[model samples]
Target: IAGRLRGLSAREARRSAEALAHELDIGPWMDRRALPEGGGLSGGIRRLTGFAMAIAAPAPLLILDEPTNDIDASRRRLLWDALRRRGDQGAGALLVTHNVAEAERIVDELVVLDRGRVVAAGSPARLRGTQDNDLRLELQLAPGAADPSELATAPPVRQRVRTGRRTLLTVAATDAARGVAWATAQREHGLLEGFTLAPATLEDAYLALTAPGAAPGSAELDPADPHQETAHV
Candidate 1:
């Protein structure tokens, strides 16, 4: 139907749709109908179909809202590649998403919104600022952690932020090994489910910005409008 709507011949429509199905790794389910919630295709596949439909429309510019929301990592990579190809073919897209880490893989420009208001806008590199020089130690707290931050109090931990079971400890590059070893020991003591060490990304900057009364070096909010903050990263 997408091809017909686009005025493609019957054969062309089938070819186009099937090719897209293969691209989205949904070729095997081409004939199956999709249902919502507890329906035929899994929720993730249904979401993938929606993305396929949008791509089928062949819009010169697409407004995608969290297109990769339910998608797994491999298929998500396919989606990103598909969009990059579309851009190469002269199409454009305005992608809206909250998966900051994943979105960094493909977004050419980013606009971070906080409570429906713009908080920051820039290319990923521009937004990361000096964050690349810092290492992030991510810890997954065990169930019912009374104080997940107890492990973050040590020296190398220049900053620590906790949300739910996830905790991000920021430290300078020189302290990367020490930070990792400390988090490793904590994991052994059953304080953490797991932990990973990596360079901080835009998400780190974003968290610091939205954090109530964040420090001046990372971000600064206009005193006149508390809601507005400039992300220096």
Candidate 2:
């Protein structure tokens, strides 16, 4: 109906919408109603439908607000891919989202905002901060671990971020073994449900760049870069 109203022939509009639906793997819900009340497509499915409708339009610029919220991992990947295709075709987009970890790989440039102020802006690599040599140890604290913050005191642990029962520890790449050993000991002692030690990621850098003492902002834009960028706030 949207396509037809936009001057697209029924067949053309349907093909466009269906193609997008399948691309996002929501093909099964194409015929469902997006009723406002109840018994319609689910929250995730409804979001997918809205996404299809947006891309179906011939808009040159797309402003996406938390497009991946409530979306599953696989479909979230598909949605990002669809946006990438849109960029490849010369259209541009402004992606407003807090899921920087998921959007990191796709973003050509990243702009970090703190309290409505632009705290940092640059290519993902440039903003990775001084922690390029760092690794992240994500610890899933056990119920018995009364205070997870104490783990930050481990000799090689350089930085830490804790939210609820999960704690992420930043350690030097050279000390990966020691960090893993420490987490393993905690897990062995039942202080952790389980823990994962991996190399630092864009999300880790995002946390660092947004730390209290970070410089106001400094980044040179590359005019030659793609116009589609993700803004992380």
Candidate 3:
């Protein structure tokens, strides 16, 4: 299969072998037909080679499993761009990735697995649109920062204080716009330095769906336990 697809012929194969070596910027490695042990190319080079080999075949459907793994961020972005371009050209691509941010950026659909079970499936926007959790705001205070407690007085629903050199604030998703308004008001009042708003992520959706009762970073199970099981001995 490899021979036929890679276009291996006595003359054509030799030419392709030479071309592949030159294309990959390697010399005399085609004679070995294998990368040097402990002297192999970088992750990006290997990934690019694999991608080139796949593109050389010009297959209709490309199944990439963790194509971005071990690749540098720049190369990962390049690969993503290439995949998107391929998809735009009507090529079918199935990308399996655990990086929610990357998936959000590239994937048109999502299939979530939990405990070996297919739990949820949909597009990224659809999934995120279904979530009701409020957006989060992180406020970075400048040097000689003033307290934000004044802005916290009897304001909105569900606010939490996070102390750092700067303060991090968590609020309900519905309150995001209002929170920004409040932050702006605080800025006017000289109670805040700078602020950022973050939307709900795929990780949030996964947590909400898979472990509804589990607190973030807390092992203490929810008292309003829904998934709590009474196992038979």
**For each candidate, what is the lDDT?**
0.73, 0.72, 0.59
Clashes of 2: 0
Scored by lDDT, model 2 comes in at 0.72
Q: Candidate 3 — worst ten consecutive residues by lDDT sum?
A: 224-233
Q: On residues 148-182, what C-alpha lDDT tens digit does candidate 3 reach at each position?
A: 64354524533333355455444567667777887
Model 3's alpha-carbon lDDT is 0.59
Each prediction's TM-score versus the true structure: 0.70, 0.69, 0.56
lDDT (10s digit) by residue, model 2, range 30-132: 7776666635667778777778877886778988889888888889889989999999988888888998786678888868887888877777766654356
Clashing residue pairs in candidate 2, if any?
Answer: none
TM-score of 1: 0.70
Higher-lDDT candidate among 1 and 3? 1
Put down candidate 1 lDDT per residue, 1-233, tens digits, no spaces.
87778777888888888988999999888898666563888767877888887787466898899898888889989988988999888898999888888777788888777666565667775555444577778888989755444634544555566777987776678988877777777777788899888887778667865666555334342244332224542
Judged by whole-model lDDT over C-alpha atoms, candidate 1 comes out at 0.73
Query: TM-score: which candidate is best?
Result: 1
Q: Over 4 Å off in model 3, which ranges?
A: 1-38, 130-134, 137-174, 177-196, 212-233
Off by over 4 Å in 2: 4-7, 37-39, 130-134, 137-172, 175-196, 213-215, 218-233
